[model samples]
Target: MQADITVDTKGMACPMPIVKAKKALDNLEPGQIMEVVSTDKGSVNDFQAWVKQTNHELVHYVEENGVFTFYVKKQ
Candidate 1:
């Protein structure tokens, strides 16, 4: 999916991905999408739970060569 903003959290660990995602999401308007590229393996589950709790939509995600790319749309 296309995103209005993209945040690269590659090489960062744990909370950092979520932290950057939160900040990026904060800057977006409702209905805007944010793309996050993270190298942390745990980010898959973390982003899923975070989006559920925050009421955002996890548009989709893909893993290639250990890099996980997530597309989230703000509600």
Candidate 2:
């Protein structure tokens, strides 16, 4: 099963996207997917490390044209 949420954080810098993503994840139920799109390059690595630390599942992530997209599942 798969569920998706999209977060757009353009023009935002470090910690903002990560902060918002964490907040959004709090509202999600287990197994739900959250998709975060950020213009911040730090988000790519930050999100990845966060998921690893938190034990959440990271489905996929990609960056294109300075846009970073992450697909993570709530634990």
Candidate 3:
């Protein structure tokens, strides 16, 4: 899926990925998509919980090699 913004947190650890994602998402308009690429394994659960708590939509996510990619739509 294409995104209005893409945040690459490839080498970041735990909270950093979520933190960067939050900042990127904040700059997007409602219904716009934000794509996050991270190497942090914790991002799986982190993004899930963050989306739930923020009422955003986790449009899709996939893992390739060791990188995780997520598409989130702002609500």
lDDT of each: 0.93, 0.86, 0.93
For candidate 2, write residues 1-75 as lDDT tens digits.
244678788899988999998999999999899988899886677779899999999888878998888888888
Better of 1 and 2 by lDDT: 1
Name the weakest run of 10 consecutive residues (lDDT summed) in model 1: 42-51
RMSD of each: 0.7, 1.8, 0.7
Candidate 3 residue pairs in clash (backbone atoms < 3 Å): none
Clashing pairs in 1: none
Error of 2 at 66 (Å): 1.0
Kindly give the number of clashing pairs for every candidate.
0, 0, 0
lDDT for 73 in candidate 1 is 93
- Kindly report which residue stretches of model 1 are placed more than 4 angstroms away from their true locations once superposed: none
After superposition, which runs of candidate 3 have C-alpha atoms over 4 Å from their true positions?
none
Best to worst by lDDT, what's the order? Answer: 1, 3, 2
Global lDDT of model 2? 0.86
Q: Residue-wise lDDT of candidate 1 within 1-75, one digit each (tens)? A: 778999999999988999999999999999999999999997789789999999999998999999999999999
Q: List the lowest-lDDT window of 10 residues for candidate 3.
A: 42-51
| TM-score of each prediction | 0.96, 0.90, 0.96
